[model samples]
Target: MGVQLKSSSLSPTVDHILDSRRHNSCLTLDAVPKFACRVKYLNLLLLSAMPGCCFCEGMALSRLLLLVLVAELAAASSDVGFVFDGFTGEANLSLNGYAEVTSEGLLKLTNFTPEMTGHAFYPSPINFKNATDGRPISFSTTFVFAIVPVYPNMSGHGIAFALAPSKELPGSMPSQYLGLFSKSDNGQASNHVVAVELDTVKSVDFADINANHVGIDVNDLKSVNASPVAYFDSREGVLKSLQLISGEPMQVWVDYDGGEMKLGVMVAPLNKPKPQVPLVSFTINLSSIVLDEMYVGMSAATGAATGCHYILGWSFGLNRDAPPLDLSKLPKLPRQGSPTKRSTEVLAIELTLAAIILLLISTAAVILIIRRRKKFAEMHEDWELEYGPHRFSYKDLYRATKGFDEQNLLGVGGFGRVYKGVLPTSKMEIAVKKISHDSKQGMREFISEIVSMGRLRHRNLVQLLGYCRRQGELLLVYDYITNGSLDR
Candidate 1:
């Protein structure tokens, strides 16, 4: 009834409409002409069969993917830049400013004129420019000051960084505004102040700054109760002085990220790129400051007493914040009794001398042993001749001594065992000594005793009546001593 068409073209149109309806089920198939429906349907089937042909769906999906990608990119960028606070690289700041105090007045800067009054005012402040784009950065400052002739009972003043509303740092403000002037003279007038004080003069037990000491104050410029962080001499005990000494340059750095701030201070030798002194690093929350840009510089003032302070140089970085200090760059230390070349040489000499001494000792021992063997051999030969072999047969001695009966034993000596015996031929009582086969000193001692006694024939001396030498066995016959031995 509605004019149906069944051509091949209409088949495609119909397929198109059908496919569209399947994709979006609310599509109105009735709204399409019959012929166009078939064509639309065919087109839809072809498009559906294709790899990527969903127009509206693809557009919507692409948009969602793009949003996700954008979010990921933003997150990545936020983490891509400088991430830490403190002096990272070789960047540093130097101190070369002037500070003076007088008895009746202090130096003041106003109207292009300099005047001296009892009131102390910083003449020049060390200027530190942030060469970086206007990004909040972290910064720290440290300086050395030496009090002349060191005041014993006086409490010292404080130090400050003046980011004043204006560049013209005038002398009239109270110490509370900027600790450039004495806080004792004026009570907390300057609320826009940040100060770090080294209050050595306030504490009676505090050590002198001139004697390798320093104090650090943060945020409380005028209050005496502001406890300070302190630094003291290293083991070397070298006092740091602020009068532009060769090694007194103070190193300061400011590091800033979007939401973080850090400051660091280091003491370095003049003309050196590396800092050789102790370093202090700190962080501050910068969310409260209204300004995104700031000027960094330092100011100091001496009291009625005479003193001096100095600054060297300053540097800054932008967009890129400072990373944490490597700290490993500080210095290489020495160890006790390190094996230096000199020490090695000394040891070598000592070893050589010791080796020579040992060689001499070993040679002496060998020679002594050789000579002893020769002497022993000579004595043994002489003993062989004098005592004669077959002096006493084994059977004869055994029978005479009653087979070495214990009761027949006369005594003992270091050389051998002695026993009473009666010689069969001479019909005389004699002492017989039987040498032990295994004694370490047996051969030499036996030979010596035999040879010595064999040549002697005295009434007082024991007679070497005769001896037997056979098969590593020895027997000695001597005139008997009735009164025991000489020791007894």
Candidate 2:
């Protein structure tokens, strides 16, 4: 008959397309298998088109695409590295990581000086070059190192982290290698290298022996060489002269914020949990090197009499492609307290003195007013003695002036109004002077006119016959003179 087949023993391809079943009919089997296979392939195509339907599958595909994108991005960014070669050409290697030169192989690096040598690590005999054509590499590198002696009396040379274009190693490295130190015939100093030096060598010019320090060299090779653009010992402890004995590891960190071109340095002891003791710190403008490529590496050398130095481990990180550093993380200083209680008391005393002055002025004003009133009253009484009181009451005075009518007014004076009237008692024409209550001069003028007129009895002069004072009003009676005052 036809080929015998068990449902459980179906081929993988066929099983994938069709469910378990056993049948001997060839026509049914062929048609069913064909339909099942077509359906399975169609479902796969639909799933691929509608990716959301397969959540897990879609996520996996997305992640793979993301990884590829990130890799492409990183490759496109600037490349950072370290160079180690003779001081003649550019260094071919680009290195980034933790770097150190230790006494007992504690921190080791690729290019390190052998032990028991009086020379420093990364001896100047070994020059590292960094070369990039047009693209500038932005990176931060640190050097952590310690000196170790072959014998108890032996000391090692100093080292430097240098940025240089040449590959030719210097001939005469100083006692500490003083990284980049070289003598010149000009006596001005060798102007070849730029370096940040960590010097351990003792000098009388420096403050102390165990002093730690950091310095920036521009166009100079010797440690003591003078330069205008260099900053040594600053408030931030960048080029401190404090020394660290052999076998003690010191750590330094240099950071450059790309936007500001500011380079910052921080130093600390390797064993401490906190960065309490800072060895070096500073900021440099990197705008000039924005387009220039630089080699990031360490360099050291031994003098004619001394041996080679040792460099243990070395590494660096390129932050040129990384995000900008946040300035808010820096520490803030404490605010000072307010002035002391003694100062506050002094201020209070000054204020009290001013208040006393003001009080004295007010009291003087009041005394002046009282004295003026007393004088006015005495003058009025004197006028009454000379001119005598007006025999007429207030009613008579008002009637005589026609209830002080405007039509009866003779003229206006600075003090009050003068009105022409006929007194009923004397049946004689006269002038009634009404002094304004609001005028201080009106009161004085009334007293003066009455007193002066009452003293004289001359025909040519105006006669002051009587006067009335009541309810803040003053009335003066005088024989009516046909002519006005001489001044008028």
Best by lDDT: 2
TM-score of each model, in listed order: 0.29, 0.34
- Model 1's TM-score against the true structure: 0.29
Tell me the spans in candidate 1 whose CA falls farther than 4 Å from its real position: 1-159, 169-178, 181-190, 196-200, 203-219, 222-259, 268-283, 289-293, 318-488
Cα miss at 306, model 1 (Å)? 2.0
TM-score for candidate 2:
0.34
lDDT of 1 by residue, 209-230 (tens): 3422223333333342222233
Q: Considering summed lDDT, which 10 consecutive residues are worst modelled in model 2?
A: 1-10
Per-residue lDDT tens digits of candidate 2, residues 28-84?
Answer: 222322223323433333334324432124646645643553344333332332322
- CA lDDT, every prediction? 0.40, 0.43
Q: Model 1: how far is 16 from its true place, Å?
A: 60
Q: Candidate 2, which segments miss by more than 4 Å at Cα?
A: 1-138, 150-156, 168-172, 176-179, 185-192, 203-212, 221-243, 271-279, 287-291, 302-309, 320-488
